[model samples]
Target: MNNDTDTARLRKLDQDHHLHPFTNLSRHSQQGGRIISRAEHIYIYDSDGNKMLDGMSGLWCCNLGYSQTLIKDAIYAQLQALPYYNNFFQCANEPAVELARALVEITPAQFSHVFFTNSGSEANDTNIRLVHRYYNLLGKPKKTLIISRKNAYHGSTIAATSLGGMGAMRKQTQGLDYVHHINQPYWFAEGADELPDEYGIRVARELEQKIDELGEDRVAAFIAEPVQGAGGVIVPPQSYWPEIKRICNERDILLIMDEVICGFGRTGNWFGSQSYNLEPDLMTFAKAVTNGYIPLGGVMVGDRVAEVLLSHSGEFAHGMTYSGHPAACAAGIATLSVLRERNIIKSAADDIAPYFQQRLQTLKDHPIVGEVRGIGMLGAVELVRDKHSRERLAPDAAGAVYCRDRANATGLMVRQSGDTMITAPPLICNHSEIDSLVNMLSKTLDQTAEHFNIR
Candidate 1:
């Protein structure tokens, strides 16, 4: 940890100038927040020198952990060779071109092209334009409506926010009229009374209902996260994805998988689409593409969309100044190299993931835990007042907020989305680290139960 950091001074400075995202600004300014000064592997040290296991993987991005020197060295090497370059005016940089090729190689066979962006929000914004442009080129200009799931989080940018289905985000700004939303396959909250498979099918059918209501021709595409990450790691039932895929295929509605959080082995696969056998026409990727060491994101354009965009005569007229940044692309290359060379992703899937899921499952017997659902490295524990009846605690998500604070106080970082406590640990965690994480979480849950006077 950095011993020289003046924790109080830094906190004061942050409160004065730094406005955080998705935060209660006034409360944050008054209380301040943990100033993370350093990180190594899966542990982050705050300004006060307190180390905490980062169970949320640094906002669900740093899959390779925090100590990978390869990505850092790669960025330095790129900076030394060429500090900056633009991918406009028929110009291209080596790192950008190479990273694009690497992305295509690792992603599903259908994806043959990539359009880079600086972050997931920009990537999803690009998706909206690309989807509309593709249909316009094919002479179907009216196919502009996009269908998303309720509680789904895409990004915070205006266009990306419009594409998402989060009520709070939508309430902050007027959303685009073309974007629509349907019921999410959140079985624990929305389908507790029915068998999971049956509930999955029923919720999956909502997409069909939406398409029919909008008229199939009027709908441009349906976008969704393979596993709803920000929506509390809501892993849909086994019957969900297949039925959704069938509906998309039968209705001729394009499927856009928002792989921003689930991409790069979070779901124990290179991409979440592969995990659920989803063949989307486009996939939004960010976060782990560079292990969150640098900002880099893009849309993996499948053959169907690529061919149409490529065949069009004129320019697409949408891009960012930092799109395909040389240094960011270099970080991406090095991150992918480490993931492949060390077999980190495969190990996470075949070995670490099973152990992680097993440990998480043990929390199901907790009195406050109504359900424990997870897949691969991501998991969530639903907090309820009555487990048998699935009755949510009063004051909405107060219980989850309490549990999250307790976990943080116990040196474990987790997230609370509504009444669900979610986690996505770094893929590099070993058996011992998994045990520690689970133990810390169990202790936090126990304390929360005691606070609520529950067994």
Candidate 2:
């Protein structure tokens, strides 16, 4: 089709047929939409030919970045060989096996088995079901509740959402009764004056207290993101993860780390579990598994958990049609190959990420910057009206939107969650690209401060 025809058709089809996820449809209809024609390296080209830097790395995935030929070739080759397969009924594909093996090689040593799904949500949903069922099969049916930290983003599926602590996500839905929440180990908002270890331990104690209140028998597992991603990149205090690990071990409750955002080298380590030193029994992973090229996610179960699962009868009783899709699996293989062969993790975490953070820290001097937090390639600049008091910028004063617009106008594609501008550039970013990213963001910060009339 011609460009004009394609654009018109897409606009019409989108307006009529497409219901975008996590969006207000009615409002979107009025505004039409931004059409991204293509992406190259760290830059996305809109239909209007404007280039924008992808600061959020396309929802915190895209580690290998856009238009990598290796991933394309893998999918093509897989289609030529075996395009699809069913993992059901004792059948599995080569790519699935290879992908699972690849994950095992890189993931924490504790995770020995991998279960596939189509997305992070499904993976987490599977985690909830599998963990709960494992306990039930062990004759502890009363152990059901999955304790999650407040402001954590697990996933959007009912069970996964139930584990998440975002107030907005929990608002309208009738949350699952089996899930419970505890205070996040966010020292910034919760205990600004306290030492990191002290605040972390204090917040970690809440888990024990909640277990007592809910009755230990009722709690089967505790789930969390190593770093709170969607809830504004809230990194925990130093003492938190260690204490959490100890508590879970002492109580015999399985620990589930939702690594959907922080997995696959977004953090300095291969997984957020490693970054935080979390020894989890079950974990959900996606987003970066295939660099978002194809939808693929899975739960990595520890040997103990897997052993318990295998002992039970009747197939574990859950799966999606797209589970272990050959093409997606092929893409995953290629993505991992690129990650390991190129040593992207070390490059991002040890070299590039440190540079990213060093440049990002410059913004902390700005009056609007309350706190700058992140690890490796992922980072966030939090805007505030009063830094000392931790006063948030008024919502929709166009604070975040204004900054995003200014960045895009200057050929940068930064995303904002609340008042924080999040950045997770592709792992392939070079030093020059890194400098450009920081310069563009710095300029946008200046513009935002000027727009708000802040000193």
**RMSD (Å) of each candidate, 1 decimal:** 1.1, 1.8
* Candidate 1 runs further than 4 Å off: 1-5
Alpha-carbon deviation at 76 in model 1, angstroms: 0.6
TM-score of each: 0.99, 0.96
Tens-digit per-residue lDDT, 1-455, candidate 1: 44555888899999999999999999999999989989999999998889999999999999989999999999999999998989988899999999999999999999999999999999999999999999999999999999998999999999899988889999999989999999999988889889999999999999999999999999999999999999999999999999999999898778999999999999999999999998999999999999999999999999999999888799889888889999999999999999999998898999999999999999999999999989989999999989878887658699999999999999999999999999999999999999999999999999999998898
lDDT digits (tens) for residues 1-455 of candidate 2: 22666777677777777889778899877666767888878778776666787877887889888978999899999999998889999999999999999889988888778999999889989988888889888999999888998888888877778889988789958889888899998776678889889999999999999999999988999999998888878888888889988898899689898999889988888888998778888888999899988899999989878998888676688998889999999999999999899888987787888998888888888888888887888788888889989776667636977888888789887777777887788887888888999899988988988888888
Highest TM-score model number: 1
